[model samples]
Target: MVQPAQSPEPDRSPGPARSSEPARPSDVPADHVVVLFGATGDLARRKLLPGLFHLARAGLMPRRYRIVGSAPAAEALTDQEFRTHAQQAVAEFGRSRPEGPAWEAFAAGLSFGAADTGAAEPLMAAVREAETALGGTPRRLFHLAVPPVAFTSVIDLLGATGLAADGKVIVEKPFGTDLASARALNAAIHAVFDEARVFRIDHFLGKEAVDNVLALRFANGLFEPLWNRDHISHVQIDVPEHIDIQGRARFFEGTGTFRDMVVTHLFQLLGFIAMEPPVALEAGPLRDEQVKVFHSMRALDPAHVVRGQYGGYRDEQGVDPASDTETFVALRVAIDNWRWSGVPFQLRTGKALAEGRHMVTLGLREPVLRMFPLETRAAAEGRSNELVIDFDDPGSITARFLVKEPGPSMRLADGDMLFNYRTAFSAQNFLEGYEHLLLEAMRGNQSLFTRSDGVERLWEVAAPLLDAPPAVRPYAPGSWGPDGIDGLVAPYRWHLPDRRDATP
Candidate 1:
């Protein structure tokens, strides 16, 4: 569903604030100004600032650079504090921390604004000032990295001040808590920003490995012809979190895996892998195809979806006891499309899972019938040609295919065509996920971002599931999820790694 970002290039425009555009441009220079709405929050402090800094480190900031972060808490915000803030993100997300002159250059490019102090006015002034300084028309990108609660306020202010209509606004996940809330938010956003101008953020789609799914299917040989129910028994999309709900317990309690992962993240990935090829890779065509996938998803009532909660985890330090939240989720979904019809697309995700992972596992059913005249039990169990794409740590891809053994009598054996990310490219060749996503956003490439319809479709499938009473079960915090998860992939025998530690 997502494509990896190319490295950062330099920002070349000559307009307002710090510069008119960002200082980097791995892709084409961004045509607009990026206004970061929540400049001082944990996300801004942790992911957003660091993400932008990484782009700058990669030399991807455009020529006319302006990073105007607007937070109601922005007033009284000092330049030194902003620098210290960015410095921390720099050390965290920036692969190689910049210091001395390089650090100064990067720091100089950043500027902050406060919402509490009437600083948003200054922020707008700064933006216009920067454009005036740059001597050209500049596009604008407003990244609403604020809390969901703050999103409405930010948009309201942006619109009140005429900033919202000036350019595009990039919104983060959990667009709404459920179908009703999502509709409300969409209506609110529609009031100011047109659907075309809104780009919802789904970071999963921007990963290098995820984007490779498209290339593997469309670009590779010997795949397109065999990519269907006859070939694929089912598909698996797993996005596990190794870390516990450290600080998100409050926000997460009101939400669960269905809202957290399935609605936007996993569903988007599914759409990409299952949707019809877009008439064109441009924003509208690509998004239209994905919207169709959403419409095609067999609307799951409460009966079709299942939820499991790990008991011991709530007793852990970070979780809440009164919570009924689901740390792990496994659901069997299907797309009513000719290509994926009858094939169950199992999506499993959780926080505090066995290990950290984000992967798409494709299981291709073996030949309908084997070489033997009368099939044996092994022959009945189709050989599974699995293609595993790992997005997080231990990144690599493994494709399992059937092969004939060299020594044994004409018997079929399974072998893997492995492509390890580490062995193929130096560890240094890879970029951080946050860095890649931020760069794409600045370059005006919405291809990696989620579309509005995509977001709504995800909710359509997940809202009913969330409302359904879950099949509650508990597992250890560090365990691989519920005990019965493996059964979902029963016929194919969920092929886990052979290593003992790999089970979790």
Candidate 2:
């Protein structure tokens, strides 16, 4: 089996006491049933089941809850058989093994049902059984862990069977192939569920480090004043994965790096970085601000974009030998707004690269006046000031600046001020992306969920490139990307992945 990449474990050592309180009684979700579609799939075994187990262990789940797992008839397992499979999945993929009272209790709540395409009766029967066991008409949360192609069928099943009535639904990424498909999908979803009842999952936004961007910018006096074009030269959101497609050749062939990473993940991160402060931190205001950022974004220019395919990709199983699909992409995105007009936001993502990094870096402009001699200035200029937010597990924030060397003759050396999450917070308190997002959805907080308008706007922003994509260049595995990418961000270089500084 091809497992997903594992992030570093957080430090377990105790730190300062947590400043936040437990969720209020009202904030806790009421008794609910989570109907997990595609329950026998890889995502369910790898993330959804494990996430639910962790949430139960953390006491974040509702007191009365049940998980009704559904899959195609051919893949369905008996309830006891499904429980055994779930135990194995949790043992292998969960942060903690399933071996105690908590595991037993969680496993007892899991059951499986079978449903074929255009058929919702079996799944609805399973839901009814779960509700009967839970005693009341519990609220439902439908988690679509299926592939993008299966989204419409499952959604149509729900609407036809009255399963979507007053229930919230969570759908995964690659929402649509392009602008037209995105609009059509949005219309289909809106037909079944209202905007408020839809939760479009973008796992990147659930990371603590990503959410902290707002706190770091708005809550602090030092960063916000210099957050605009006047003080920042450029912004970089770089995500490079060392691992290739694993066994997902068919999926990768249909959806290249642009749709998989850029439209879904990077654009969301950009909204978080480039958006003006919302009136409040609530869901409506936050999403409004994000949509506004999308509104100001200039459509992607094909000339400023670079697409690349890793060598040997076409040899993978289920891949087309003549595939022109790009596994790597780099683009110079422009946000034609007041704050970020002059500053370029360079976004890049790739699979099978030299290293894997999830980071957002802001390059600070040089000082207005040069006080030092011109000869010595070159050395100082090379080490430009940078503010970086590393979103890998055990996240951190680092600010790089030039420090005066301790010598008779003045010289500058690179220095960094860093705040690491693992050292400052308890490891037990840390939540993985899926776990965090699952809990948030149950609590009815849509702050991290993508709205319909935002989705449409993102498609609009990417229209130019999708209409006429640049040719895909070939790059060797374990390399950064194509040679053509060098000119995409001229003068400014991409931030190479560095774990040494983030190490606790």
Best by lDDT: 2
Model 1: lowest-lDDT 10 consecutive positions = 1-10
Q: Per model, state how many residue pairs clash.
A: 42, 0
In the order shown, the candidates' Cα RMSDs to the true structure are 6.2, 4.9
Tell me the whole-model lDDT of each prediction, alpha carbons only: 0.68, 0.85
TM-score of each model, paired residue for residue: 0.87, 0.93
Tens digits of per-residue lDDT for model 1, 266-356: 8888888887777777767777887888999987765555567766657755566666778778778878888888998888888777776
Candidate 2, clashing residue pairs?
A: none
The alpha-carbon lDDT assigned to residue 147 of candidate 2 equals: 91
| Tens digit per residue, CA lDDT, model 2, 1-504 | 111111112222233211133444564567788989989889999999988877776667787788989989888888878889888898789876676666677777887778876765778787888887887678899999999988998898889888899999999998898889999999999999999999999989999998899999999999999999999999999999999999899899999999999999999999999999999999999999999999999998999999999999999999999998999999999888889998999998999999999999999998999775433333434436889999877589999877777889776667789999988876777778888899899988999999888898899889999999989999999999999786788788777536797776
TM-score of 1: 0.87
TM-score of candidate 2 on Cα atoms, chains taken together: 0.93
